[model samples]
Target: MTLEGALIRSEGLSIRHGGREVLRDVSFAIEAGEIVTVVGPNGSGKSTLLKALIGALPPAAGRVTRRAGLRLGYVPQGLRLDPSMPMTVGRFLNLPKRVAEEGRTRALAEAGAQGLEDRPLTALSGGQFQRVLLARALLDRPELLILDEPTTGLDQPGQAAFYQRLEDVRNSLGCAVLMVSHELHVVMSASDRVLCVNGHICCEGRPEVVAQAEEYRALFGTGTGGALALYRHEHSHRHDETCELDHTHGEDT
Candidate 1:
């Protein structure tokens, strides 16, 4: 909330696409070494916010500021590699920038995809491919890791496993994480803070608080209320990692 040493901050940000405003007056700050999840229904500008944060999209108004000399790594919601391209995992990791073999192997191992270097990119299953993408992001040892729905196609168990692996990565690297996810059940349990968005931030707080907020319930309905209840019961026993002080701040409109 203080914005001191924030890794990235958006101040009254707005975005436009195709002559229509997608987001308006949205603002938040991601601090160092915290996990923040953005949740919204489809077309709520969740992904748009991510692109703007990463500088892939220009803001129509307001500003996105990053700490000086920030190192950022991004894992997109989906990547379409041409099936015709004959690329191996090792080669893929070295794209645009070449990494030493040792670094590549270590990153892959950390992403839970060890020994996948020589395998063709086409040969990997959906889960393995996601892990490889995570490996690529880790190559730079980023100070801020951004993921846009990195667990799209995985099943429930697989999604949990992937998030667990992500938690491990964040712990070991000591990097802040900003992710956009639709999985309320998983994100509520995993995140340090959760922001609910509907073209603008509706509510934000520690997951439990947001889950109970009228804004969140109005958007997601009582169906997910059960998930939040389940999360409260299981979360204490699950994530043993310590979180930084809760820094959730936003107007609950």
Candidate 2:
């Protein structure tokens, strides 16, 4: 079921890695200005799904589609810089091409690393580095921003802060965001929708509802049932404008 104004969607998607099926029969769509998070246990094909959406992987079956000429920005999981080579944030953003000063500054400010242009990339803390990567991803003014486990090694507080900043960026840019993470608090509070995966999409729905799902509990354990309290955010308005149907459904991804 392809959505009328979907920014990106997958239909009966199946994928393989090294002769083994990693994802199967997955289907979902993300509309403009939506924040969708993909969560699952380790080796559950969370990252593989993201790769498939962004056209990095070929499907063994099914299809993935994007809006024609869609502008995309990607921040891969745990991007590391060689410490031996020194590079400033400003210099780094100019790589392969130069970005206008106004645009670069805006991207940096949106990511909450406003004065980091002069800082060495290697000198940044884990949180700061993630912000820089986010800033770089935002430089192209993407209509859909994709991330894979962007908060790999941040502390609890750092992870929370990054997700908050991500929300702010989404609002400012009015761009759809699709990210893969194990952050359950984000599933409950930050994301407009959630997809829980294990080989395939086990379940998907609204944050609080999915958090309490039996399938989610089975994969993540009951310990995460209470993680919803870690970050609490309420919506004054409903998501009907962007969500065609209630995502609190136990249907497809």
Query: What CA root-mean-square deviation does each model show from the true structure?
Result: 9.3, 8.7
TM-score of model 1 (CA atoms): 0.82
- Please give the range of 10 consecutive residues that has the lowest summed lDDT in model 2: 241-250
Where does model 2 exceed 4 Å of error? 184-188, 209-253
- Clash number for model 1? 0
lDDT per residue, candidate 1, 1-253, as tens digits? 6799899999999999999998989989998988888876667789999999999889999999999999998999888789889999999999879999989998999999999999999999999999999999999999999999998998755776787788889889999999888654337345788876667776566655465666556544654433331112212222212111111211222
* Model 1, residue pairs in steric clash: none
Judge candidate 1 at residue 104 and give its lDDT. Answer: 98
Looking at candidate 1, the ten consecutive residues that score lowest on lDDT are: 242-251
Tell me how candidate 1 scores on lDDT. Answer: 0.79
Which candidate comes out best when scored by lDDT? 1
**Superposition error at 181 for model 1 (Å):** 0.8
Expressed as tens digits, the lDDT of each residue in 41-94 for candidate 2 is 667798999989888899999999999988898898887788888999999888
